[model samples]
Target: MTAPRTGDQRLAGRTALVTGGGSGLGAVLTHALADTGARVVAVGRDEAALERTAAARPGAVLARQCDVSDPDSVAQLAGSLADEHIDILVNNAGVPGPVAPLTEVEPQDWDDVFAVNVRGVYLMCRTFAPGMTARSDGDILNIASVSGKRPLAGRTPYCASKAAVLGLTTTLAAELGPQGVRVNSLSPGPVDSARMRRNFTMEAERTGVTYEEAERRFVSRALLERMVTEEEVAEAAVAMIGLTGLCAADLDLSAGMVAR
Candidate 1:
């Protein structure tokens, strides 16, 4: 298999399973993997969006609607994909939790955030790790956030869940590395995505600022003075999976954020 332009393209001829592939960074990662000749299985709760992602490369993609929080649905999806052994698993499915302080946040919101961010990653890893271990050559990339490392005032549950994911990635890397299966977590800053926009809107309302002003302030928080693009995160994902000798246990893809 010939590698593509980016070193991440070393994934050529492999099979990839990307959760949340219907949109945001997940969609970009799916596109990048397909570009490098990997057959991709795109999973999400939105069937139509998944179909669109599949349509981009009809022969190279299988779009499946999956609610990662629901074990039964995940089991069914796993059964359906039994014929396709995955070589790269990207646990990108996530939910933006309520932008409320810990005291104001509802219990249900916290539960839902952990269910998707932490439990979803655990479920995907459990479902796929055996196959990767048996093959003795595969990569697992979990999409975490910088907020996981550095707490955000109003995102208590999100911060907790992402921190758990970072810890999980490190533990899995240690457990799976000996089997030639690499597990890593990529922590991105505020990415320019639909979710990011929605988050900015929420911030604006909560802080009594204009959306544009909130976005500006948010962007200024990063060293680059802008939100990182989804493509950049995808690029990092590909690089983490592609380069042969580099098995980073935890990769921080933040565009120059203060490390916590």
Candidate 2:
């Protein structure tokens, strides 16, 4: 999935850090951000994957391995990058929790999801917001999901965690707006990626439906009747970062999912 080129260096000279930047949509975002002439730090738990992502953009994108769910790891990451002021932070690290009913979900599984999806964002913001506040400039984009606004049966943990992210983004925007730091979130619908494929496969098995049928049912809710592409989400992230006045906004790149 190739992101459309803008031929514009809007974010030139900016330093951006993207969590979960090793693979999937995160990798796409890292590339997109680098294309805008921003030096990007791609952080994730997988060293090999992060290396591959950084290899694509060479010097423009640096790969770092850090588990966002760990406080010490996040602190260490912040310490390592202390010399460079991060102008943009994309909290894209998240996990799709168990695809089962609430009763079938284990407490630990729920905690694990929150650890990455919710706590991870909190930790990143807590660590980095102060620098932005002191400088009086920065952009924080939290990748959320449409499942938070609508219903995704049997995905309580994932849904709840994303909903929390929306709340966090808005409140933080208010808290930090006066200080000149912009906080916002991008909520994309079921993106066409390996993650969603796994989700559809699980849903099919759980509901006794064919994989195609399960996927169809999920996309049917969107007015576009299709899953959003990774490129679309990445493009939206770049656009949000460039939009200076856009703060406390939950940009729904969900193919009209919320409308439906």
Q: What are the Cα lDDT values of the candidates? A: 0.88, 0.94
Candidate number of the best TM-score: 2
Across 16-123, the per-residue lDDT of candidate 1 in tens digits comes to 999999987888999989988999999999999999999988798889999998899889999999899899999999999999889999999899999999999999
List where candidate 1 sits over 4 angstroms from the true fold: 1-6
Residues 100-191, candidate 2: write the lDDT tens digits.
99999999999999999999999999999999999999999999998899888999999999999999999999999999999999999989
Total clashing residue pairs per candidate? 0, 0
The TM-scores, one per candidate, come to 0.95, 0.96
